[model samples]
Target chain A: MSGFTVYSATGCVRCKIVKGYMDAQGMTYVEKDMKAEGKEDFQKFYAANRRQIFRGPEGVEFPIVTDGTAIRQGVGACLAYLYAGRELDGFFSAGTLHKEWVDGIHAAGGNPAAGEKFLAVVRLLKGNNFKLVVDTYGRNPALLEKLLAENLVDVAVMEVMASAGLAGAIFGQPLAQEDIERSVALVATAPEYRFQTTVVPVAEGGQARYLTPQEVVAAAKLLATVTRSKKNPYLIKLYRPVQPKDERLGELAPLPAAALLAYRSQARAYQVLAEAEKE
Target chain B: MAYPSVYPTGVTIYDPKKCWSGYTIFQAKEAGALLIDMNGTEVQLWKGLHGFPNTILPGGYVMGHLGLRNNAFGMQDQTDLVQVDWDGNVVWKFNQYEYIEDPGEEPQWMARQHHDFQREGNPVGYYVPGMDPRVDGGNTLILCHKNLYNKKISDKRLLDDTIIEVTWGGDIVWEWTCSDHFDEFGFSEAAKNILCRDPNMRTAGGGMGDWMHVNCMSVLGPNRWYDAGDERFHPDNIIIDGRETNILAIIDKKTGKIVWQVGPEYDTSPALKKLGWIIGVHHTHMISRGLPGEGNILLFDNGGWAGYGVPNPGSPTGSKNALRDYSRVLEFDPVTLQIVWQYTPKEAGFVHPPDSNRFYSPFISGAQRLPNGNTLITEGSGGRAFEVTPDHEIVWEYISPYWGKQMKMNMVYRAYRVPYEWVPQAERAPETPIERIDVAKFRVPGAAPLGRKKETAIEGTKPYQGSTALCIAAAEEVDEK
Candidate 1:
């Protein structure tokens, strides 16, 4: 385990966020897309670390990471380790850290050598304990396809931005729906992957340009149509607007807790795992 | 989740000493609503629930909808509205699931309510404090969605918006659906035919077919117009707006008929078009008898795509048109339809219209006529709510910092200003009083916070090493999206 390998998801934003966090800490690791060979490529890695990765009675769920010895699975489990420092003690029991790691960095007075946040993050992600990133597949995911063809990756995950009516406006960019659908199809067939979206409203200029609750359900239905995974977890995350003020998505409102719940109820029609993530 | 001294969070651009003295209440799209003073201290967390059209009582009780259940095992996000005491106790709870019944229909039950709800007897729920000429008893007015059908209207099943008044005893005293009075909405023959074919509206239950999304509705309350003998402006009249069709109308609550409306066709009409197309407006409220411009309509003009564009003789009836890029706030006399005052990006100090996107939220913005003659506007999408004087000077402003229960971000739905007298224990803490800063000169100190950490990866490179090289193409492109 010279450099712990990450079976990266096809297109998962959390995977990206996690990787970014790790980069700030200066932790080293190798990244691979799990969908490289469809199920075949994922199967090899799955065989290597089968037990530590799988959970529940049936052995499902993925984005498994191993230092060739111990392993970590699921975003929550990995975050607990990444933020909790070394020892993996209380890793499963303690859960995610709510303290802002950047606060420690800020307190360091710009001295990267004395940065406690970086040191803590690196210590937590140390050794064979690699990470898998996730996000919505990028436009024209030819790289994702090529990676899937290679079968030399970890896992895959994606997110549905909005339903058909809002496909073009919400992201402040051309969504490239054909590629999204293709990536969705590829991930759905891949051995291990997840799909999600931030249930937040997009505002352009000071007004709300976010999809209505109706559009959220519509997007879920669209995802349901593409993925055969009946229980495909559509992780509806609480939205956090992009920082430093990008001109495109000015400001956005996150969906309300209750309205989000009602939305999950509405999405139940699609028979997918409509889950809400507390930001 | 970390950003440096974010706007709408921690009083970024505040003139605490200059703002009207009182607490502002608003629910972040993700975080539950909070009541804070000029100093930006949380008077009440009112956690566990999301604020939508929430109001504070004379006591310390906060009334709002149950936002998200963080501890629940099943569908945690249920539509259960609650009233909490000062200690955050559940004083009253209305589960939309158990209630919301419609008589004489097969399923009979309406879906969960969204956007707005009003408590009739209180008048406290009204945007302004005013006296009502008539008493309808204490009932809650709810804007709800339901799949409905009627032979009198189109036979095709439709997702209709219904306004129902429910009593504390759990009885629906009155019910009104917009679809029933379809003929009165003033749609052209072509518009009507096209709407029947594709009534563009969006919602979770309606899939992609929700037509006439009634975003906000409230009993007109007492207004000068009624005092001046305009029966149409009676306190009991219910004023509502259709986001999809862009129809701002006053329905005679007694007759349940739309007596006056401004849209469904602004482009075709001279009077309406000059006032500008009221495309996708929200939070329509009569200024109340006591406010400065009482009887005038205060509307947040959300400029965006709405309605089925009527076809010209040569063009098809179902023509689609691009929405105007700019949004405006209009305060107009309802009877004369004359705009008394207005605010736009240009007025907000923007150089050009398109640059005013900061002022334009195609949906989810609101306006309030404060007692001090200043208008408190919630640029809802931006999550920035501020108060501006009659002269258009911004005095107080806040951006919501709490991310919602489910999402990492939060945007405000609407915000209201209340006098210090309104909150019983309003002075739970001392006000720190913030001084407005030169934002251009301000910067967050130290290494960039987590949110400020920019992506620094080289194109197609891994953290460690591998001989696979990389995709190599599209490598120069940024990953900002």
Candidate 2:
């Protein structure tokens, strides 16, 4: 098997993790840091692969993944490719899905008729993987249940309003306890889905609410009960603070190690509890 | 012998055995003690100065160091400005004060008055002070005041990195600062994360500092193309480089905005990241405006920063820091911002060591467009200067042996060639014959033998026995001349 190449720069932790993943797989690769002298050849190589180079601040920070022919941006995208067991050809292809869908429409006996373009669009949607984007605001519980029962989506990511105080301030709509309970009941009947809550620090007095390990565990437990499954769900706590400049917001303070460890331990405990409940 | 005389146009020409001819004052090496002439003569001009003198111009006016002083940060033991006449008399002087509390005071006053004042540790002033003069016909001086780590007052005051042009009376007429427009500058989350994590990013050490560095300012229009409308000709569109951020910026005088800038934006295209084009560049200037590189700018791409210079063993990425070999004089289109033409040692036919590979040291260098379509380049780190023809052929070359105390760091800073018409004859220094020597006859015996066979021992006979007798005969004949 031919190995891949990774172009990276100094002090990039994401690049390090990508390289580490490739190493764990026992994959051979050549790493080039474009910030070196006499590496002009590699620079040209990367430029040819990606039409335009992305310069990081300080003129460094790149972790490019390539299997000799195609390149991808970050380790997350590269891992997605590895998981799919496919090369990065379709990822950057301009209209690969459109072409595939056109051919699929023809095969479905959708004759080359007057409405062929409309049928082709439907065929394209059915040909490849796409998760439906559903905006839930005052959405009826019955409609959500019907969609869930029909297995319309392979996976669903639903945004849940946290509390009346936060919901009124953030969404400009007062959320009742009955509304949240009904939504939770509808989601609990669905097997393949997840719940996520976005926390705006500004809504909470410009300070991110800190959840203790036990509170996080309890929240995960309640979320798992609503999902009606033993699979531990992800509780992503987001902090969106109001910053003057976009650049200032780009600078994210690292989570304190103690808090991170506490969160991780709570997640582990939640997973253990879910596994035990399944048994 | 004749005494040097001055002409009306301020041009100084040398008579036989009278004054130094066809030479411009480049820089005072050995810490302002010895002056390196354009013709490669290092003449000792003064003594007992620590920092290099800032400006050396005509009319017997030499402005530089008076002595050392201190400030709030630390002891800036080598900072002062003194105006000396042709007779070596200190006519005017300024010493460092504690601080400048008023925001209305001209930035140049703070620079001239403070010893510790620097534009982010970079010596502020002209590279070759008198090479370019103010257009309005006043004694020209360039002063830089760095404001990276200083206290922020107002949005206008935040543009602390300042370069100013003042009259002889110390009135600030023209100035350029960075903070006026770069306030909107943005960086990506990843890049900002790295900067915030790195402690050295805000300090003067490790090249990154709070003060944006504004180094090496030049005034135009003392030449033929002094147009009032042309932005490049505007005596105020100063080109400055931030030593830490590796940004070459051109500031517009009218709006106090960065008219042109090249560096990493928050969302940079992938092609630029691959090329690593903007790392540690300096000495920016507009070259070949109406010529072959028309509208293209030239600069010394220092390539010194995170991955520049020698390899660091403690680097997070186990990669060696690559030293820039062969810094090129690149002509880049300001609009598309692409390199159009470039000059390197190999293409220019300059010789390097056999093991040098492709590495050429072009550190802290400068390039100037010549009248005859050639380019004058000063490879500051190499302590060498040469003239390259339009086709990149080296027409003239000179190696400076007038190594100054800064020679240990192996830098020449800046150099300039005067047209011999700029200096007044009355103020010109006398010419002295330079002694030259050849080293071919001084080789010692070979430490290694070529073959196993015993070398023939012909060493007993002298190599130049006949040449010695001929020299004595020639000396007797030279009793006349």
Candidate 3:
């Protein structure tokens, strides 16, 4: 149980490479060729695992590497877990989270923390036996607002970004500084609403230039002043490249350790400013 | 006692009761009649002597030959090349009569012009002229128009047959004649004479012939010998199967020599022989790559041929006949020459009476490996065609409602499915609307002729009026004679 079991078939190049890597890392494991021995037993195990994790049957393929508590169905899944340096046993054993739910959140740029939070909310609602409903942004907002007023959902996770901020980034229409102030004022009326900003590095010329830490801090302070809110909102800096195919972005160096430290310091300073304003 | 179970891929039984009339199209009976669209309904495009029924390729185009019949004194069959659109319009046609001649003698054999027959003046020759014409790449026409007769010739030497590549306008672009390279009498003289003496060797029921009669031609890709850097995956090669010799050969179009061959050197490997016997196979087609069960050769293994192994008595042709009851689609690895996959009715969960048997006749049947991983096989003798899935389940079945009789013979040579897209927009017809008529209200015409005097045959019927019944009886007698 301390070691791993790598179920593979003969003539699979990927399986050989994976086993070689494990050996180099001094990890002991049991190897099984499903084709030569225990084909039916392996199929039964595979089907059982699939039913537990996925609602439908998974395609039958070789090299299902399992560490007693966790199973990786194919090479792609194995590689992803190896890079993450974490086992999915806890999440799977909980029986409350599905792989598809986690994958969907990840696809939409939601982090692991957000995924856990969403699962927790779903569990709470289900335990209460409430008929929960969810809709996309394009759905009728008035109906959603009505449901919210009726106290149908004890908690709701909604996505909100400044319209002016998005239009400026996507359509190259620069918004005046007052537009940002006005947007904050408009959303401040809703007590449950939270403002979210995604920080993406923009490439200009040959170097990736992120919004200066001082500028972010100043914006945060100004927003708090206009909205008359005391609590600093959560700022999630998503680190995906703005343009996938831009060669300049790839050439640019990572954020220097010193620069990252400075950014964190500025964020802390904004938190202090909001706290002081609340007092 | 329990028998070992064989699991099928899947089975889907189609019930006619749940089906609705989809469409109806009429096919003409001309020699090379093509399906054409007239007023939105499919009609045959009848032109100069149509002979063979059209064959549908992966695309919608139908390819077949045009000719009357092969006989001496120029009364023999001459092949006319043709490609018909789905709506039965002749998109292209080529006439080879000018270059071919039917010398006054015995029935001019179509095998004479094929690439496996020896040319005239060769010590041994088996040339039966005017045989099978095949079109490849929608532009090139490969004709196996000759045959050879020589006993001592090695199977490879039978490459003397000519495979002519002509354009749509009848221009011979390139030609490969087998006689120039291989010697017809290269084999032991005894083997040569025995093959020549058997005049009926090429016929289906004749003893095995020596000469490899190239019946079908397919081009693989451009010649790598001429242009080593040619990027095309398929080279310009031709596939010829000798019906009499039971040889499947691939001839290099450029060199006109046997590049690769199966049979004559075929042996059932220990593994395959342990499972079952697969003797003579025909209508070999290359299953397209990347499809389910791809990279294997699909063939109609007429297991009835009594060549190398002990013949199964229950074969379709009965005992003592080479073609008996065994027929199945076999997928074999071309390189390893191993039978990898097969489908028989028993494996598909169909139980038949002890007397019912199925087998393939090379000249009379066609098997198409379809894109959906099912095989469309035409049981020519029974005049039945069925679409079978990978699991050997019959999803679609059709019995030819129109049976042709040649001198009181009921035989179906071949049938092909015309994909709806291939028909030209102007040629396709709107679907025929089905209307049901009550049979009880139907009446027999009073003017109908009867061949004999009316009798009180029915228990409730009285005798017909004398003069009228007499007149009807006389009219029926005249019609009967």
> Among these predicted structures, which one has the highest lDDT?
1
Q: lDDT order of candidates, best first?
A: 1, 2, 3
Q: Which ten residues in a row have the lowest lDDT in candidate 3 chain B?
A: B119-128
Writing each residue's lDDT as its tens digit, candidate 2 over A1-279 gives 347777776665556766776677777788877666427857687567545344334452256677765565543344433333342222211111211121111111111232223222322233333333222322244444544555533344444553434445544555565555466566655555455443232224454344344544554555555555434345444443333442323334533322333343344333322110100
> lDDT tens digits, residues B1-481, model 1?
1234444365554554555657888885655668888666778777656665676765656677764332221112235556677787777665433222123322212225667777755442533555421122356777766566654434555667777666564444466778878888877776667676666633333233466878888778777778888888878999999887888999997788888788877766566766778878898878776778877898998887676665654335563343666688999877767789898876787544335565777778798887667888888876778888888888877877766565555577788777776677755456565566766665577634344346685888758743224443221221222
- Alpha-carbon shift of residue A93 in model 3 (angstroms): 99
- Tell me each candidate's TM-score: 0.53, 0.43, 0.41
Looking at model 1 chain B, report the run of 10 residues with the lowest lDDT sum: B69-78
Listed per prediction, chain B TM-scores read 0.80, 0.62, 0.60
Estimate, for each residue in B8-44, the C-alpha lDDT of model 2 and write its tens digit: 1111112222222344343444655334443345443
DockQ for every prediction shown = 0.01, 0.01, 0.00
Q: What TM-score does model 3 score on chain A? A: 0.36
Q: B287 in model 2: Cα distance from truth in Å?
A: 3.4
Q: Candidate 1 chain A — worst ten consecutive residues by lDDT sum?
A: A100-109
Q: Over the stretch A12-40, how does candidate 1's per-residue lDDT look in tens digits? A: 44456556666776767777666563456
- What value does DockQ give for candidate 3? 0.00
* Displacement of the residue B30 alpha carbon in candidate 1, Å: 2.4
- Displacement of the residue A111 alpha carbon in candidate 1, Å: 99
lDDT string for model 3 (B1-481, tens) is 1222321111123332322212212223332343432112335444442434444433344555545444322221245546665555667665532323335433221212221111111101100112112333323544444333333343322323455544444444455554443352132343344344432233221223324444445544223322544222234455555444445566655445676656532333554443344335555655543345554566665554433212246433221124545466677765556777776545554332121243344344456555456666655554455566766766555544343443232233444444444343434555332223233443357744534575556678766652224423432343354
